[model samples]
Target: MAKKKATAKAADNLTFLKTPTGINGLDEITLGGFPKGRPTLICGAAGCGKTLFSLEFLVKGVEEFNEPGVFIAFEEKADELALNVTSLGFDLKKLQDEKKLRIDYIHIDKSEIEETGEYDLQGLFIRLGYAIDSIGAKRVVLDTIENLFSGLTNEGILRAELRRLFQFLKDKGVTAIITGESGEKTLTRQGLEEYVSDCVILLDHRVVNQISTRRLRIIKYRGSLHGTNEYPFLIDEDGISVLPVTSLKLDKPVSAEIINSGIPSLDKMFPTGGFYKGSSILTSGTAGTGKTSIAVSFADAACKRGEKCLYFAFEESPAQIIRNMKSIDLNLQKHVDKGLLKFYASRPTMYGLEMHLVAIHKAIQKFKPNVVVLDPITNLITIGSFSEVKSMLVRMIDFLQENQITVMFTALTLSTVINDQTDDGVSSLVDSWLCIKDIEMNGERNRGLYVMKARGMQHSNQIREFVITNKGLSLVDVYLGPDGILTGSARETQMLMEETGQVLHRNALGRKDREVLRKRKLLEAKIESLKTEFESAEEELNKIYIEDEIKRGVLNKTRQQMTDLRSGNKDI
Candidate 1:
């Protein structure tokens, strides 16, 4: 009975302790790293960053937590391991000099070993135990346990020895990381290693469209809560950082701060001046409907207010965007020069969806922008399937909202009309949706803009006509004239025709009045000239009559004289 009580007491004291994973965003996903004083299995195919993860854990423990660590490499030499991690900012040589870190490389050569009938891994344990005790290490890493399988041909002995090695590490009370290569069918090549470990994490490296992405997922963790989602991780100079996306919950209270949408008219449409600071806005439209222009305008407005903004251009280069905006008079170069805006342009197929998320997260953390804009999120579909891209976007939007960052994502909707409720639709997940489309009106296609939905705020329901001109984008209020809401170039033509008709009518009436007045004046002048000519002709006729009368008198006088001379001759 005394011995039973002692056993119970020992079991009670064996409460599972938790270890902190030095990687940012990882501890949150696993509740708190791994089970302390227990060996955890990290299995992955070659070049999946399993060794880098283990190194990060050890380096973080020593640097941040002030806990000493022991690293046992079964495959790589000490100098080789040190060189591999130098880019991650880990100085193994420096840590070794401080006596706080210990690195042991077990050089195993199958040719040098004699084929014994039976063998135990106790000798390896003795060396690891000595190193752990010597530095009082709280963290330990055994990289690539599958290397032992290559050296040992006895499967029965390898399995038993692997179990015993894990048990020995648990007995030593050190948090250990044991990495193994993935098997063809099982979680690990040596399947027994996963069962003996307290937790199992799987890493995957895949190339899609010639772009590589590293993904991490927690397969199982005994006696602790863990995130079930596969997260995207990145390897850079600072080591591996996994982007944990499971913490998106809307239960938290929202802020009442009214943030401008960069568009004054758009803000006026919202009751709260604009969207809530952390609200997500989705701008979806057909091709050539001006989604990127709208997103850029939003970013410009944010930068104009002195709020930092980040623009991720997936479809267009920075120079191309700047040149395009020049036509609309939106100068982005000045904002970039002022450091109020940052532009990151890359091809959508440059990396997988997860890598894109990691890059955005890292940029956000570094720039701490108040607003983030992704110009055409649909471009990411090239790397992932529709469902995968949607899932990734949901997580990304959730992450942005948690940090109170206003994110605007532009997507190209293939359909002529997009409904708020539908499969593979982003409208349902977004806090606000602004839809732009081409509407057939008056024998021509015209751009139409509307607010499909804006939660927790009052917005305009009217469909506004959008025009792009040299000055920039303008929203024309719907005309309430006899011809309801004139649209397209036809409306402008009608307006011009009406204006030209009124001017022509006025000119025609003016010309008629002038003609009437000029005709009256000419008639009066002609009558005066004819009256003077008639009076002169009568005077000349009277004068000629007088002269004719005078000539006739003379002729009569001559005739009478001739008659008298003839009469005298007759009488003689």
Candidate 2:
């Protein structure tokens, strides 16, 4: 019976151990959420998204987790809070009417309220407790706890009551989130972090190059492992979205299926006839080097394969991109019309890097594309620092690759060399890098394409001439001649010159063959003449011998006539 009781106690403790904040990536960073039944202090200066973070925690607990929540607002009123969050599509009023939530605004103005000596916050405690019990709340949020100190004159009472309030919430077994203003030297204004010390999260808002970025950092989380790095978060229409800037575990499954790169010539470059599915492809080049052309080709190819594609253009409008792609015969508008392609055009300066990331996230969730393309990612550098851009891109790449989405990014380089490329510095992070360069020859520039890296795949090493004709984009072998690698008119001129040389060489070989045949004929005639002459000489010699024989016979016949004994003639 004692063992059974101890087991039950352990189970109960485990049940109320941690609560998920329901913020997008916050729960993952916290390793679960804030400690259950303990107060977590969220401190920041004005407009750092502190209140929104806490409100979201409570609202999500009620809506998503089905846990009733109590919101004791010390700054904004119930109506104002609801009105403020309506834009975020959080129907706070509806949640309250459904009895799943309770919002009580406790306004404490320093000028309106006069604090008497030796007074405790028993009234505040009663209100909070009644609110909690009325809804059977499991989550509580005290937004801007520093406001409570504004109406207090005695620091001793304020500090003591603050500690007691936290303890009371803990005693009630309700997970609480306390918001406070950031202090100059401390984590929270009025040192509220010193009291409600279970976990402390600090929010920071900084401006760089006239653009604002919000960051969230966990100052301390006692008795738990949490992400300590500063994560860039955004407070947009969707509420707080914190991007965990840690290197994600490289456990995402790699795909073996090869996807065509759209251009047949380009596809032939890869040994697999295409790129690996869910791999990141980077096409970087200088001005007018066909970076966008290559990206559009990829998107067109994906769409032609009946896969959805999302194109994020930072420097061009949708119409502009569509129009420009038409010159290359990509026909991006047709894909968009068929709903296989989606274009999202926006300026990089329109929002901070985090907000842009959030927007992209939202778009991805909505579109659920199989492929994503970002044209001219270098424009993003104008709005953010190099490291910031790299971090956001890393998070995005990790997310996309994990979801098995093939991503293509186009970066514009200021120069031709790879080392002096764009500051985005995503070259090493990508799976395949296709570098486009301007091949200047014969006082003209032509585009050349080469694969700098393709992880886990064999690709072509030779630079091919990239041509953008009205028919489509094509890659041809760059002409290598006596001078060097040739392109443009030089390549064509050299090609013609080589053809002419081949014709001349063929003619010379034909002439030599004819000359050899003629010499053989002449030599055969001379040998035939010598044989005829020798035969005539032999015939003449035979005739002369016959004549001599006849003459000797006649003489012998005369002698035989004289002496009839012809035996001598027979012997002769």
Candidate 3:
């Protein structure tokens, strides 16, 4: 099954022969890379990274692909070019010394060009060809092609030279990149140059809200499919990195496994015990509702399980986050020291949303983390509009889920109205939405946590008390008072009142039982006494009857004496 997916993954590159531009994320955008043995045009405004993009392509080719490259500069000197790239860790001096690279700075004097009365590339082609042959280079770059059109008055001659320059690179069988200044109406200053190139890329530098961002778009690629969307690229110490959009198919392999929410009670809320692997989770709440606590718990859990976690903090510094988490007994610094957790903190206004997304994409690709946390994504809305933030989040979630990495991001709900609705910021894009809201009553604000939705699992509908103690984060069952589900101090107060009422009820029941026993004992004593008195009276009555019987017998005996005298003759 995996083999089939792998084959399908490579199907996009099967249509053509290409040379890989080893810049991060560029190969995926081009599906294979630039077209082989063809000149590609990169046109952008000044300081838009057109030159760095080409230099990175050449340097990466030489270092990674073992392809020697020649860079022919027309705007800067060879030493200046080499010095400017040293910050990117490109050892140009060493590469040139090893004969693996060549840099030729062709001085283009506009005055000399006007005096010469011609715009031609034969002499320049000879030098470029000699440099390529000297190092057996397979890659070439012509930085700032606008210099060739500096003083040209005849459009036909400039057009012819542009065709010859591209044809020369193609004839030499080397994949070439030519950088040019963006024209007001066309892709390059020389409007006809883009027509002759096999591929044309446009770099854009846009500033929104005083924050600058760099974007790259592929205008056209002949005979090979390429992404036409504007991809965000970042230039750090390593060099240019373009964050390519995914294949845009929902064909990523799914996992049946479930991972915990790092809080045991929160995991118990779901029937599967936690979130599904690679699921996107959104934890949203008002201020001080423990949203960051949830993120910290997840990072701590991932690190505890020996899995890497990347935490992107847009508000606090790394040390501040670490110290804040420590109050909850979560030692994040230990995870940092162990290299299992990484924190990337940047202000939301540091750059446009696209560049932040690029940084996130680059960081995830480099760290290969098992999970990621974007603490409070609502801060991103300050830099971009709501739709732009949502769009950026859509792309970010797509990238994360495609990698099968679990992501738990927090969103702040600033609305004062308490309702059943979750903060709808990116809520539609997540697989699970954990809505935490403030239940303010009894002069205190308490957190009530409930699962708004958890896809593919049975989850609890009842809200729980989202507790954050010094030991850690936990969820306890909220109280059901007369008013309804009670939380925080009100819930505790209700519990105490009910406990006191139960104690009083038990004591009353015990006292009533004792009194009933005492009354029953008194009644039994009275019955015993009455029985003794009745027995004594019956004995006295019997004795009187015996005495009366004796008296009657004596009287009868007197009478019987006379009668007996008569009867005695027969029976004395």
What's the TM-score of every candidate structure?
Answer: 0.79, 0.83, 0.88
Q: Pick the candidate with the highest TM-score.
A: 3
Global lDDT scores for all candidate models: 0.84, 0.87, 0.87
Tens-digit lDDT track for model 1 on 426-517? 77888889888787876787888888899888899987777777777767755545777677776677678888998999999999999988
Tally clashes: model 1.
Answer: 0
Which pairs in model 2 have colliding backbones?
none
Off by more than 4 A, model 2? 1-9, 12-16, 109-117, 418-424, 494-572
After superposing candidate 1, which stretches have Cα over 4 Å from the reference? 1-15, 116-122, 153-160, 206-213, 417-424, 440-445, 480-484, 497-572
What is the C-alpha local distance difference test score of candidate 2?
0.87
CA error at residue 444 for candidate 1, angstroms: 5.6
Clashes of each: 0, 0, 0
Query: Which of the two, 2 or 3, has more TM-score?
Result: 3
Compared with the true structure, what per-residue lDDT tens digits does model 3 show for residues 381-446? 899988788888988999998999999999888885644453545777799999888888878889
